[model samples]
Target: MKIVEKKNFKYVDYLWDEAKAATLEGNEVDLLLYRSNLLGTDLRITNYGGGNTSCRTVEKDPLTGEETGIMWIKGSGGDIGSLTRSGLAGLYVDKLRALKKVYRGIEHEDEMVALFNHCIYDLDSKAPSIDTPLHGLLPFKHIDHLHPDALIAVAAAKDSRKVTREIWGDSMGWVPWQRPGFDLGLQIEKCLAENPGIRGIVLGSHGLFTWGDTAYECYINSLEVIEMASEYIEKKIAGNGGVVFGGEKIKSLEPGKRKSQAAAIAPLLRGLCSSEKRMIGHFTDADRVLQYINSNDLERLAPMGTSCPDHFLRTKIQPLILPLEAGADLSDTTKLLGKLEPAFEQYRAEYREYYESCKHDNSPAIRDSNPVVILWPGVGMFTFAKNKQTARVASEFYVNAINVMRGAEAISEYTSLPRQEAFDIEYWLLEEAKLQRMPKEKPLSRKVALVTGATGGIGKAIADKLVEEGANVVLTDLDAELLKEAEGTYGKDEVSAVVCNVTGAADVEGAFRQACLGFGGVDIIVHSAGLAISKPLEETTEKDWQLLQDVLVKGQFLLAQSGVDIMRKQGLGGDIVSIASKNGLVAGPNNVGYGTAKAAQQHMTRLLAAELGPDKIRVNTVNPDGVIVGSKIWEGAWAEGRARAYGITVEELPAHYAKRNLLHEIIRPEDIANGVYALLGILDKSTGNTINVDGGMANAFVR
Candidate 1:
């Protein structure tokens, strides 16, 4: 075994651990995983899920008692950095190579995907990616196909072949742009055959391919190729007086201002982009993103789109750039917002035209015409998708594109894949099939819900249920510690925590803003925050009355006002469910202050429902009589006061309340949560209505 010395590369990190490799010396698959993880650690090397790695190993054949060559490659939709053993597709090497004999041509290449299952060496291996042939057909023990930003810069340049020769001489080969499939794999094999001594190949407007006899050598070869490209690009950028993308055209807003502005416009932009289907948004004001969007060449270069298939696939063919005057003040959010609708409209129109011009007979129906990447000159970039992680990954890929553009433009004229070729890959039937194979999205998929008092039992139950149903939730409450705990309970990607005193206007507004920034705005609002003070008319003090009114009535009012404003701006009809009490309608004794507030909450739901009908915002109430289990409200003075009024011990309050209802059933927090879910998912058509979860409380029934 050759121990390759780690070179201190200026541009890319050499992260291969010799000690780690030693532990897996006999296991080529483990070595491949080690190499893959090292290469994927840096975005400069590869964006998430944008690269593939493979290693050919000898394993005992299941049928014969003989060793057979098996090739393990990164599975479809797998990210190298986080890949597990199951994420690799394992196939018989001989079986894969035999595919070449049956290959008809590029036009009929998609059929080969279905045939890949026949080549599977491991029954439980993940589905193979389109690039499987590229790895398997190559006559190397280890192979790496990467979309490093620096290498892509060289590959996407106008004179990519010339640049490749200049950078690596005859040691590297170049193949013309061909969509990844059997033919392109054949092209690479021919290129290597012609240049017998070449160490790697650069696919024009695609990416880099490097191979070695061992996994460690393969990893080194890839790093060396990318480092050389990075160094050459860096020197050229310096020679060009540090100016790239034709230099800066607009200055970036201050960091704080950029974030505030991004948060302010995210919901509206998300709504506009979501006209076809709802989209979650991710925002970034990173320096590289700012540099690209602020550049003079942004207008010319951005429209060309990304050359890498992995990039443009995630970012879309091209981003929708907001038109801003060269030196306009970006702090004027009102003015900036005015430009969004027209820009989005124009983008959609152009995208539709692009589709019409480029569609093949079997092309998948036009996907959401909305741009995945949205660029604002001074603020930064916003990327939207079905969920937060995808949105964020799209944003990251665009940043990779920006880096590629910067390097290419500095050294040579950057070029994008031709529109027709881009369309072919974007609408590839194999890609569409993979999409169709995905598990069905949950009913509340893409919906963002803001649940108040989410740390409390009812509130937490609602938040958990919403998440389970595929809605991203923002958990807000006065208890910071509990909010943090709840946030962890639900993963951060699906749940955001914000401490809010709903009665405070600033707190309410700020929480909504955070929700917009975190998950692209609120689609469902649950006013579950409340405290109870069970008191008779004689014992109820002005202080107690005021407190109940402030928390129950005023809190609901503030949350509703803010939620309504955001929902209206979104232009996506929304649901607002208030956790009111049955006492409000039943007119029970020893509940003057609390009952009045609950009545106020119930009526407010109806009023908002009537007012927001045109906007399609539904308002409803869930009235629960006695939710004792896991309820913070029941653990305190309120429970004691209610128990005293009913002439029962505090411990017996649950039985007393349950028996009081007609059906004699106990109401739990989860039951309240179910009611909220019903109003949002099942009873979506019914609004301004109250659903009592109090075991058939006849007195509380709404007329």
Candidate 2:
């Protein structure tokens, strides 16, 4: 509850001075940049994208040297913390206020948006936030509106105005809950005029607003109010045995056991929430989360909505509570599905009823009502979003909200905005319009892929192809350093790299855990890790024979079993494409070690297809031949010896083998990648089947 100056306060003060100096040195609003970052970096003050900061300043026209007052407020799509000058939209102050004189029609959210854009002083600036008018109309040099959880704990309660009075006295003004738009801005303008002495205002069920002549004054006011609210909750909830998670007495599972449990549970939740289309799920069970899910009052409190209104768009009002607890018997997978099916159906029915009751004629179209957060007794919380980044962001915000709600309920009755208010924000036209503007998704958008041996050749090609097609790809390889390098090959936003020796159980297990952590879960697996050895049967050493079998045969065995385990949990059918060599079909001279292992890999594909078919997992193979140019297996002595046997120079061996095929063309790594892409089913269905990328080898062709 205390707001003590940190040891680094002096350094922060120095930065503030520099920000002021930067403002005087020709940079527009550098002080606001420094001020926003100061608030944005502290989660206790505001979570990501949950707060806004603004300033009223004069900008001199470069051409005419005319000075005009402008209102610079946090723009849409900019995080308040780490905000820069460009992150704030600069609108002409006089022109913005002038709109009220001519604005006489029924106010619509979309129309208000257009008016805000039209008032922009600099058309090149970012789009103004929907709350631009609130900041613009306020008669102050600086303004900050933050959705701090401690303050929201007070704002979201039923008797919030009374509670806020108890903590803030008359220093803060009060405004009833109102959606952000033209009318709400006018209400605030009137409220502030009537209570001109108040230093700050708390918007019921919304957020806190503070104004001052300088950034530091408004920032300090925010801190003092937040501290008062924190103290109030602390004193009220003190020693009340608030919410206690039931698992406090349970021993923590070992790391290995914990990872396996997570891998098992993530896909099941992903499957239950998913349909034929894919949705990513991120699972976490921090100690606090486990305790909250196991709390004695969970049944009474867990069904309630978020702690504040800002989260309504990201997390639906209420979460879906699965009947099963965490650490339950996962051995009976089929039995688990049976229970989930009914629970999910009931949740859907309730969502429909809630939406139907509050929907208005002009409300934007309803989104999928499936709960975004799920509370399972043992598994903690599972958050779902269209992509991995969004799911994780929503997950963090919900976790924070849970703690805030618990604190509030422990002290007094916990409540949230009514259903109508929730529906209005959830389907608000301004937010809906943002979604409408998104471009058509790539074919594999929302899907995840894992490609093995991805540092070189066919493995790298497959990973690149998946990412290009809109899938989030996890690249795994035997070389740890190489994997790190490959991680950056694709944009960091969509690709991750992991070092996985396919032959090791721990490595394979770790790889799956990484995929789950990085992108929720995997939908497609490209198994391309292999070893090549060439020698006469009698001359093949035991080491060479063992290495080939370990990587080629045993590796596929491990990956297939693990891949199927995860895909089955997801309930969504999956595709597994293993890269096999033509040598597997047509044995080449002096290649016993490589051919035997590849042949086994090919048959393993068929066997896995048959075993996993019941779970709707498709196992298939892509047979690529004459991919000699990029492959390390065809380099150095191996290339020289193969070329000698073909009676051609090493550089000509590729051409010689390519012409020997019926099609008389070389098979490139991308060609093999294309074959793998086909089995992924973006265009057509082909599974438990083999597609040859071998330039039509007559002898190697499968009937």
Candidate 3:
């Protein structure tokens, strides 16, 4: 057994931990999982959910108490980095090998997938991935199929086989591009037979495959191959004399300027990309991304598309590039905005053409023609998807593609897969079947919501509910610490916290900007930030009245003003729900200041509804009678003033208010949240109408 010498790595990190491996000495499957985790977690090794690993282990057969060969491989749609034992599909090796005898050729390879289920060793294991043959048909005890950018650069080069020989000589084998299936697996097996003593094979315009007798040896083989490729590409890149991408036609914008520019145009780009369905966006101005988009060859190379199947699948066939001249003014948002729609439309038209030209008799209908990725010179790259994680992962994949192009172009002319081949993989019926198997999207899926006063009871409840329904939420409040605490309650991908004083114009604008950067843009706005000043007519000072108006009325106005601007730019209609008080309509005593502000908020909803009808922006109000439980207002002097006015103790406010309502039901913050959710999700058509969630307060009814 000849061991390959490990070279010192420069571009990729060597993360193998012998100490950790020792703990799983007896469990070969656990060791394989450990190796998979170390490889998958690093974007340099492979992308998210883009690679597969397998170990052929001897396990006791459940039917017969005898040891049998079982190949444990990554299941469908599982990310290797976060893969669990249950995520591995265990299939009988003998059965999998037997199916090869019945293989009917490349055209009938997809039928082989259904047979894989019959080979499952564990009835409860996850469904097998399409690339199972690439791992199962191999002779080695352990195998790895990865899509590292460095290796893919060599694989996607114009003279890929020649480059493979130059880099690894006869030590590594080379195979031509073949879509993943039984046929590709046979080609790999044949490559190994023809080239004895080869450590791995680079699949043309695809990825890399390596194998070993032991799990540890397979891990080392995979790392060594990637590291050597990285070293070779880096040397070639350096020899190019800093003239990669035809020598940077446009300089990168400064960090601050680029991000601000990204924030400025993200909503517009998001809107354009969301023509089919609403999308969440992820933006990146990383040096590598900026270098590619700002380069002279961007126009020439971007349209050729990515070579790897995993790469193009996430990014689409090509990205929509926003053309900007050298030394272009990024500050003139109007000019940048003007160029967006035309470019977007052209991209869509080209996508439709590609689909029409390449469709087969059984091809799935064309997917969204809207580009998943959009690149702007000097600014950066923007990727949109159904959710934040997918959007962010798409950006990461494009960056990987950029690195691949950089390496390939340095060594040789980069070559993408042929249009027909790319289209076949993109619209494969199996791929469509996988998509159909996906769980139904939640009601609020792809919608981004911004909730003001999010740290408060009603605000927090509304934010939580929105997230539960699949909406990414931006939680804003005046208190930074509370906002941080509130954000911690939800996953970072689902919620973002911004400290904002809604009364300040700059603060409101800045909050919206953060929301745009965080989750593309806002589709729903909830104005729940307010304070109460319950004072008798004589006792109410000018200061009290102004304070209430500023916090309640003025704050709601500022949020609406900023939110509407983003919604209009998105070209997607939006929802604005204000949490007003029943006092606004009831005109109760000792609540002059609070009642006046509430009335203003309620009327503002109606007025905005009438004005924003043309834009499809709905405005409504949720008037609560007495949300005394779990409410911040009840914790302050407002409770004391209300209690004094009602001639009752503060402790009795909940029971007293609940009894006064028609249903005698105490209103909780969640009840108010449900009202807001109903307005946004179910009663979407009803605008300028008040839905009184305060135990059916008759006085607050809209007549």
Those runs of model 3 whose alpha carbons end farther than 4 Å from true positions after fitting are 1-8, 325-338, 537-541
User: Candidate 1, TM-score vs. the true structure?
Assistant: 0.94
Give the 10-residue window scoring lowest on summed lDDT in candidate 3: 324-333
Writing each residue's lDDT as its tens digit, candidate 2 over 1-703 gives 1222532331112123443544444333666676778777766677778878888888886657999898888898788876877777989898888878766654554587788877888776889888888887788888998887777777776788888788878888888888877776777888899888888888877788988777666667777777778777767666654334321434445546655666666777787777535788777777767667766666776777875666767878888887865567777788988888788888878888887888889776656767789877655678888877678778777876775675566446677777887887787777788888778888787888888889878898888888888888888998889888888777645888888999898898788877876666888888898757666778789998999999888888888778777887787878888999888999678888888898898998898888888777888999998889787668776777677656789889888978888989987888888988888845345567888898898888888
Model 2 weakest 10-residue run by lDDT:
6-15
Model 2 residue 648 CA deviation in Å: 6.6
- Scored by lDDT, model 2 comes in at 0.77
Which pairs clash in model 3? none
Candidate 3's residue-wise lDDT over 284-317, tens digit each?
8898998899888998999999999999889999
Off by over 4 Å in 1: 1-3, 14-23, 324-338, 536-539
Please state the error at residue 656 of candidate 2 in Å: 7.3
User: lDDT for each of the candidates?
Assistant: 0.90, 0.77, 0.89
Candidate 2 lDDT for residue 533? 69
Which candidate number has the best TM-score? 3
lDDT of 2 at 245: 31
